[model samples]
Target: MHSNVVGGSDRIGEIIEVRGADGTPPYRVRYPDGHESLMFPGPDCVIEQGSATAAAGRR
Candidate 1:
């Protein structure tokens, strides 16, 4: 997760399906084993995937 509130937080993940009314809702990400899990967001939440792990040093 990175900063989102102009000082808030932002996260990255492989999107599965965006569910909700305004398109802001929970997401599904694939695990290392190829299994997926739901990433539920709170009210007025948004998600974005950015730079690769290699570039972010997450690799």
Candidate 2:
């Protein structure tokens, strides 16, 4: 996700849980850092779904 702060790093993660439907906020994400957070994606954030091929590559 992109950050509103200048030079804030984007994060790549798996969506572990979704608190709402219909593209809602407060999503739980497990990041590559092995930490998780309940995120409310802001205007600067861009969420991308991981492809099956990409998931396989991680293993």
Candidate 3:
């Protein structure tokens, strides 16, 4: 499985650094603009598993 970043969604940030927040995956996302936020992995974000994002990377 892999992570997917959707467009029109809240832009976490560029070079987004993810961590576990409250034990949640993608706990936090840091943007290049010198801003960071806590991500809720599923509710606020989702994992994308398909050919579209086959890089097997993160958001």
lDDT of 2 by residue, 1-59 (tens): 76667888766778777898886878998888889999888776777788989867875
Error of 2 at 26 (Å): 1.6
Q: In candidate 1, what are the lDDT values of residues 1-59, reduced to their tens digit?
A: 35447866455456556766676656666544567777776645545565666435634
Candidate of highest lDDT: 2
Off by over 4 Å in 3: 1-26, 43-59
User: Model 1, stretches more than 4 Å misplaced?
Assistant: 1-12, 42-46, 49-59
Model 1 TM-score relative to the real fold:
0.40
Most accurate candidate by TM-score: 2
Instruction: Name model 2 segments beyond 4 Å from true.
Output: 52-59
Compared with the true structure, all predictions reach lDDT values of 0.59, 0.80, 0.48
Residues 1-59, candidate 3: write the lDDT tens digits. Answer: 12355444454343244466554465455565767776555555445334536434544
CA RMSD of all predictions: 7.8, 2.6, 8.3
Ranking by TM-score: 2, 1, 3
Ten-residue segment with the worst summed lDDT in candidate 2? 2-11
